[model samples]
Target: MAAPLFLLAPPRSYTSLVNAMLGQHPQCFGLPELCLFNVDTLVDLWRGSAAEISENGPMARHGLLRAVAEIYCGEQSTATVNMALRWASVREHWTTGQVFQEIVDKIHPLVAVEKSPSYTISVKRMRAMLDTFPDARFLHLVRHPVAQAKSLLAINDGAFTIKVNAFEIGEDYALMEPQIAWHDINLNILDFLDKVPPAQQMRMRGEDIMAQPEQRLAEIARWAGLRDDAEAVDQMMHPERSPFACFGPINALFGNDPNFLAGPTFRPHTPKIPPLSKPVPWRDDGKGLHPEVVQLANEFGYV
Candidate 1:
């Protein structure tokens, strides 16, 4: 099987674009966020705990279904999507690792490129990924937490972090924390990296990728043991060219973020760096980044 390359990071850290970009390489297959490892069995992706029950409890399954439909059936239609559903049912008892291996094997000779921010939610989940693919390559993607948190709050009332329980309950039962998701998720990546060989992993700043696409992407390709020549670098430059870059068939319109799917263009421009000393948007009162967050931003080369 081609080596499975996983992008490890928290949500809103440019994983979607970067994953798609790397996937566009001729020898790589870019996949949407398949949160398969969150459960033991394929069917567990559809099942939900009583406390978290919702109509979309199995939200992660859509990506797998659409991917299978697109790969096997050549199009992600209602019929093909149903077939994909059946495919999952056949392996309902399979572990996520086994299923992931199956997909990688099916796409033989082409590297599997995937990023599931959900992987950072639990140390166990990250461990599962490492255990499953001991030879897997990892890219620890980082972004300025201030910018990430601002973007997160802008999207859905900061509900994404809330869903992950990346918040603190104060004595008054108030959400009193800031950058909890950013800090903890990054810590997860750092801790997990200790278990993997240094040669098999790379750390990248999202800003660097955005600001210097050709340069940084070529570096990434070289580090991942892929071609870094002109043609390969050219291919990696156009993330929008990836089939999964856009929304899948209407039946499964998205296997990734709707916002990213809507605009998957690659423009080389410097991202606006938010001030670390500024007040955070998620809070009513003015409170800026903690000392540790500043240290992290500096460590991430964000200044």
Candidate 2:
């Protein structure tokens, strides 16, 4: 079986768009956010895990439910989602790793490309991915800290930051700070990636891919031992063609970002990268990125 390709990055880091685009490669199967590593067994997905983070809601299960429905039943619908429930019930005791492998096996010969930003919250979840697929390839997707932080705040007033416990605790109050999650989650990914073999890992800035997708996409496809010819690269350039690029059935509405889902199609354009030294637009206090955030962004090729 071809090992799966995992996108490791914080939320709002272009993961949904990139994952969908990669899945459009003729030899790859782009899957919705099958957040399998967030728990132990199939049943644990429903039981939910106790942790400081809290995005594991019904929406968290949408990806797996939709995946099973589409992979096994050949569609994502109210009926198929229910079928997926029964499917899970039969294998409820199986480890989440085992369940994920089954889905990957079902789509054999096509590389499974997936991204679940929640996995960045805990190194244990990432380690589980390696434990399941020892030869798995990881793509550490990064965005500019300033750009990413602003996006985080723009969406739901940066509510997702609360899910990661990203806060600035002042002497008198605690305020939601998107950059905290940006810094820490990236740190989590870097720390966990240290355990992965250099040969099995690759890093690329989200801006580069957005700006020059054809060239950069070809680079990654070549590295993954996939076809990088014009035809293949052209296919990858149209992420909207992927089956899971849009909303699923009403029962399984979102396995990806809602914003991306609203407009999953990719256009050739460079994303603006904000300067790390400037005060972030989201903050009223006129504060710039933390020193550590800037240092790490520099290492990621941001200035």
Candidate 3:
């Protein structure tokens, strides 16, 4: 069995593009967000989040639904997606590990490359994935906190973080908590990575990958014990070339980010790096990043 390669990062951190790029490699099978570890059982996905209705809560089940439909039935047709639900129904009694192993088996000999942003919300969820794929290679992908937070707010009225249980309400119903998602998610990744063998893990900045795709991707391939030749790097340059780059059937539009699905092209542009000490855009008051967020950003090579 080929060991899987898991990309560990919070949302809007270039995970989708990077996953697609790596999947385009000859020996790799980049997968959309499988989101298998989020729920204790497969049925819980349809149960929705315990939180009230939010912009992102309704779409939480999308990744897993798409993955199952694509993997089992080949295409994500409505009928196949329904079959995926039935397939999950049969395995509803099994552990997530067992279910994941079954999928990995079906795609045997090709390395499974996956990144699910929701996995960063809980240490337990990360642990669950690790326990299942003990030999899996992890790519700890990090982004600038300010850029990430601003992008998160821009997407869905900041409801994405809220849906993940990362926001807090003040007396005036104002959201004033600092770095709740960014700080905790990175902590979860760091803590979990400490348990893995150094040989099995590689940490890279999303900025670095964006700035120097060839060099950073080559390093990643080498670290993951895959070929780092010209062919591999060239393949990693075109994320759009991946089989799962486009939207699936009508019933399943995305197993990945919708924005990425519409346009998965890779243009070489240096993303603007926001100042670390400046005020964040999400807050009414001009307060800067929390001390913890700064430390984490520095560790990620942002500062």
Candidate 4:
């Protein structure tokens, strides 16, 4: 079995695009955000986790359902998705690792590439992936804390911060802190990666990938033991070409970010990297990133 390539990053770090792009490689099968490792069994996903904040409802199941439909049934349609539901029902009792192995086996030889940012919230979840796929390759995708925090705040008022328990509790109130989320999530990834061999893991900036997709993507392809030739490089350029790049059927409309689903096309351009000292745009208080956030950002090679 070909060990899967998992992108480890917090949300809004270009994981969806990168995963799809890599999946488009001739030797890869880019998967939607399966989020299977978030739980121990398939039934746990439906029944929900202990933490209400972690419970994802039906939308979370969409990715696995869509993937099952496409991989096993040869298409993702209403009928196929319903068939996926039946498929899951039969395997609800199986360990999530077992189910993931089945999918990896089904797409053998074509490396499975996936990213579910939620997996970074807990070390256990990431360790589950490593335990299941002992030889899994991990890509630690980093982003500027300022840019990532701003993006998180823009979405549902930084809802993910709450999910990660990233907050500052003042005497009067508790405020969401995106930078904390960014720092902690990356730290979690680092801790988990400590057990992985150096050769099995790589760290790359999301901004770098955006700035030089062709060169950087070819580098990544070569690193993953995939084809770095023109044909494969050209294929990797068009993330939209991936089956999971767009919205799935009505029953399973999203296996990736909704924003990405709406416009799955890849347009290469340099992303703006805001100065660390400047006041974050998402904050009303003229405050820059937290000291810890700045420290981590510097460690990541950001100015």
Best by lDDT: 4
Minimum summed lDDT over a 10-residue window in model 4 is located at 48-57
Tens digit of per-residue lDDT, candidate 3, span 239-290: 9987679887665666788899999999977889987899887777888898
In candidate 3, what residue range of length 10 has the lowest lDDT sum?
A: 49-58
- Candidate 1: clashing pairs of residues: none
Clashes of 2: 0
Write the candidate numbers in order of decreasing lDDT: 4, 2, 1, 3
lDDT for 23 (candidate 4): 94
lDDT of 3 at 233: 93
> What tens-digit string does per-residue lDDT give for candidate 4 at 116-233?
8889988999999999999999999999998888888887777778877898888998778888999999999999999999999999999999999999999998898889999998
Clashes of 4: 0
Clash pairs detected, candidate 3: none
Clashing pairs in 2: none
Task: Provide the TM-score for each candidate, comma-separated.
Answer: 0.93, 0.96, 0.91, 0.97
Residue lDDT tens for model 2, 1-303 = 999999999988999999999999999999999888998888877875434223566788889899899888887889999999899999999999999999989999999999999899999999999999999999999999888887888876777898778999999988788889999999999999999999899999999999999999999998888999999999998888777778999988888898988898888888877677888777789888889998999999988
Each model's lDDT: 0.84, 0.89, 0.81, 0.90
Tell me how far the alpha carbon of residue 282 in candidate 3 is from the true structure, in angstroms, after superposition: 2.8
